[model samples]
Target: YKAFEPQEARRILDKLEIHYTPKHGSWLNMAEIELSILSRQCLDRRIPNQEVLKNEVAAWQDKRNSISKPMEWQFTNQDARVKLKKLYPTIQQ
Candidate 1:
């Protein structure tokens, strides 16, 4: 189960004895990420009612899924070594 509010979420977590970390930081939460993506792809500069929002989001999701691929995460230590040598700590060469 999940909750949107911190107090309710804490209550549920305590009852379930489960521990989870929110992405980003303590104050920077997942809702911000979701809202940013939704705004850019579906809601930016437009106030579609609930039904239209749902339908448009669904259509956009369908189209995106048809061509979507997994993201490539390539910012490994080696990339950082070359790109940010000054900031990165020395590694075995």
Candidate 2:
């Protein structure tokens, strides 16, 4: 492979500063997201009875499991800092 250019070097440096989130660290968030999707896909509809709801949920779950879809996480550290600025303490200059 060819050597990295100046801009590539800068990008690498920026990546080095990014906060690495542990895979297990975001399991709760992942579960919530999956539940939200499940709600939108099937639970949001009006079910006739408990039996129908159970079948619908089971069918939807089987359909989901049939395909292997990986989670695509696009949130960056900069996004977290911007969206959750209130949670982080500010430094007095």
Measured with C-alpha atoms, the lDDT of residue 1 in candidate 1 is: 35
- lDDT to native, each model: 0.67, 0.83
The count of backbone overlaps in candidate 1 is 0
Per-candidate TM vs. native?
0.43, 0.59
Query: Cα RMSDs of all predictions?
Result: 8.5, 14.1
The 10-residue segment with the lowest total lDDT in model 1: 22-31
Model 2: lDDT to the true structure: 0.83
Tens digit per residue, CA lDDT, model 1, 1-93: 344588887777678854566443443444465457767987776755889878888887787678765334456768878999999777687
Q: Distance from true position, residue 6, model 1, in Å?
A: 35
Error of 2 at 12 (Å): 48
lDDT of 2 by residue, 1-93 (tens): 157888998877788865555563386787788799899999997899999999999999999888868677888888989999998888999
